[model samples]
Target: MVIDRRSVQRAALVVLPLVLFVAARAVSAVGDGPLQNGNFEDSPDQSQMSGSVVAGEHAISGWKTSGHIELVCSGQKQGDMVLTVPDGAQALRLGAGASIEQQISGLTQGSYYSLTFAASRTCSQDETLSVTAAPAPSGAGSPAPAQTGELPMQTVYTSIGWDSYSWAFRAEGAGLMSVVITHNCGQEEDPACGPIVDAFAIKALHDQPPDQAAADNNMLRNGGFEEGPYIPPGSPWGVLVPPVDEDPVSPLPGWKVMAYKKSVRYVDSAHFAVPRGARAVELVSGVEAALLQEVDTTVEGSWYRLEFSAGDAANGCASSSDGSSSSGMKLKAYAGTSETTVDIDFRGAGGSNRGKIEFRAAASPTRVVFVSLGYHTKSDNSGTLCGPVVDDVSLVPIPPPYARRLLL
Candidate 1:
């Protein structure tokens, strides 16, 4: 059958402008889109953002990693964006996925995500900023419906977070990627991060590499991460920052305990109590904070120092023991340079086995102390795993060592 030319011409006129208008709008929207419009994390899958880097008309994208990333949008900072391959898959379920994490001193706050995903044109967030996948699924709190006969969606339901932004990463795959913008929730949840999405991206996290000077130290016989050569004053000495789960214990000045990085159960509780009346002196920190404070009998000399000092130059020693004996013993000490030929051995006289010890001194030589105790024991250092027990420390002076001066 022959078609009428005039009818076709008339139809074209009606359809042409609508098509042109739609195309123009899309171009304009791309020009003014958010950079980080995506629901992806900082791992592989960054290039899937809705408004990724564009070159003229095409967008430049790449897989993401656990590093720095950025995203931006133009026209408006509101509305949902697509930033992944358009497909017929559902959103990933977040059992307990973390989107953001804020850590301060000894506190942490963030979200744990375990979301179920679905295929949709857009995503959204309520006024409250609780992110929600658009086209709410049949199940109130379930992932979206999977696409009809498509490549199995790459599912990622992991517990991860970033120091900034919403989370540590964003990702979506086998679908036209998209992201609903949100803001940082100042540890709790930043209202300012909302109202409208600022910039969304998969690359919003980064960690600086280790320093070069200390790079070789990793292989040297010196110290491991946190454990190292005697960190002196004026230097960023190594110290263990207790984990949130740990409950640090404190005892009398003379009381001590024993512990190691590999083992913790022993030091978690005080074995030998430093009774309520035990002489507790305010010894300097960093120098003597031994978990096991006892006398060493292995090395010909029986004298050792109290286990705690804030300074490293106060020639001292710290140790812990079952009692005071060093042979076939359990002791740890933080010993500083004897400096002098005559060792002012700080001894764990009270107990027969020195269970722990810590030695430290101020950067200045004279500041280091060796509170030597004239304790004796038949034990030796043959089987002693002796060292010091401590964490990041600072110094404070007391009566005898404080050298106080009246201030105006």
Candidate 2:
């Protein structure tokens, strides 16, 4: 075959562009950010013992310690309990006053980034972890540091083992940014009582403001009850056995518990089946306990759908049919002024069912409430206190009339 040099050059030109395009896509998928050694697999020295890294030390590549931070290896421990790393072979342990930070350059100004990581409690009690991203320190000639919004601090409990968490933030001015993860637990005699963090990752989100993103997406926070307060030992949920006259506060985040009378409210996980996530909330002790939240609709007169999973908490609690006092349990959900109720039979305990309701937003902010009715009888003669389990609650705004017409 006779080969033409000019024809060969033209074919090479066509294939070169395709190769470059694929390479560019591969680079983008890997992400260009400052987070390095996110899995904690890279250490200056891979030691089996729990090693302490002080502030200004470079024990972990691309990360700096702010106080006395410990590098915990998998299956290592400081006390009687063995510390299990959430991901990879190593994890960073933050005590009462320790923190770890990483600074990355080349961020676009006004862009959004979603930070995610896994956290687990090292001690038997609960601990709080705070993570933030801000403008890195710059020279005098550099642009002034951009104002950064505070991310909500996460309170992790012992019941939540190796759970992943996420926070979104925006870059004020795109120069260099620093991401810091700190332990905010109170001082205690045992320094090992804190949160162990691993598997850190950051991805560039849209350019929209964080508040706008949240409002446009889902108006409900912790709707799945995954972010419930710490559950104690031997209890399925965060058990609040208040006096018969005093109302106990809701242990789940972003939800309020209003009991008409003193009763027990359970932030459930680990004991019963949860419809979604690792936890669910149950109203166990009171005659009625209501879980309520005020969700911002962002647009008045807008149609929104409220969806949730409900079931009876069958933690061996005897139902009314079990020959105990009072009728069986029920779940009442109120979106704005519209209400829907589901009867929970003791025979159907531990079974999850889905329910939803649509309502028009009369006001910009709408009230969503879920109430538990009836009393639960104890299987062990501990008295009736069972309630319905509520999980996977979500509120999504429906399109306006004009938008619906356009879609049609």
Candidate 3:
């Protein structure tokens, strides 16, 4: 029998590539990065588009879109209004009931992840976006329940008319998981008027072990505001930690945003002046923007000292609309029954001042809260909200020899 060597060699070439592709897919992990076509830059071809509305399910690369999904270009006009793209030259506008989903592979089971995206309302005064994470089916009994949250777009926190939001969800029993963004509603007059969204990204979140950073005499973890969500490049506005976020899955680990209607800005040194580290929290909405943390005191009823830095972010936070420089900022720190206010008359020179608060722990886990006192906006742009920066937070119990008696 004669064996054809050419046939055998040709079959080997085809089979080998398939085997290697499967092997690579099995080991690849999707963690802490942007999704494919996250900025919606890979638009649909002319055949896949019906004017601005996407016509097919797989029209957008790396995504399955439904309903009235429109691909919008920057500066695209509707009548006399210009549509602004948050990032890149193209963005997605989901009409009423429209949704876009992408299936991600290689997510670890039961690991929490933060989803960050940029969004803005187009014509509706009251519009909302629904984010859902659905776990892929495992061979086990049943799939995990889908985690979903509604983000309101009624409030415009930034001067640019758009903001970045962070939401947390756990990766459940999955080989592949779907991350979805849906538009809940639009204007009554025009159902196509919805939200423009871009810059989708994710970051794996982890809680620090007990006393992990205690060696530096700081009882709180991530007190320097370094460990948090991933801030995309060129995002000067920073990420917003909403009040609905809890400590367990908060993008800002170890700290919870307590404001009900407003969100605290997570600024980085690349765009703003951070006090002690690359990152810090800006109390932009005055008292409406606050940070809270429950820290474990080594000894109950012990004396503890809370020290932090406060100053203007120097992102034009001091100048008034009338071209006058007025940089008076106030921060209030509260721990148990003790409270202290720190005042910094920042001149926008890019530095911070320290504030200290010593108090007695009323319980094992004492609650520490920080809030801004006055509402402020940037001097260069009055429409932009700006505030004082808080960083280098530290809390430690006072030693017995150095402890002092309180008169109050």
Clashes of each: 129, 8, 1
Q: Best candidate, TM-score-wise?
A: 3
Over the stretch 37-82, how does candidate 1's per-residue lDDT look in tens digits?
Answer: 2333222234543333211211222212211122322232323643
Candidate ordering by TM-score (highest first): 3, 2, 1
CA RMSD (A), model 1? 24.3
TM-score of each: 0.17, 0.53, 0.89
Q: RMSD per prediction, one decimal?
A: 24.3, 10.9, 3.4
Question: What lDDT is obtained when candidate 3 is compared to the true structure?
Answer: 0.82
Q: After aligning candidate 2 to the native by TM-score, how far in Å is the CA of 132 from where it should be?
A: 1.7
Top lDDT prediction, candidate number: 3
RMSD of 2: 10.9
Worst 10 residues of 3 by lDDT: 318-327
Per-residue lDDT tens digits for candidate 2, residues 90-164, read 888887767888876666766555565667766644455665677776655666533322222232222334554
How does candidate 2 score on lDDT?
0.62
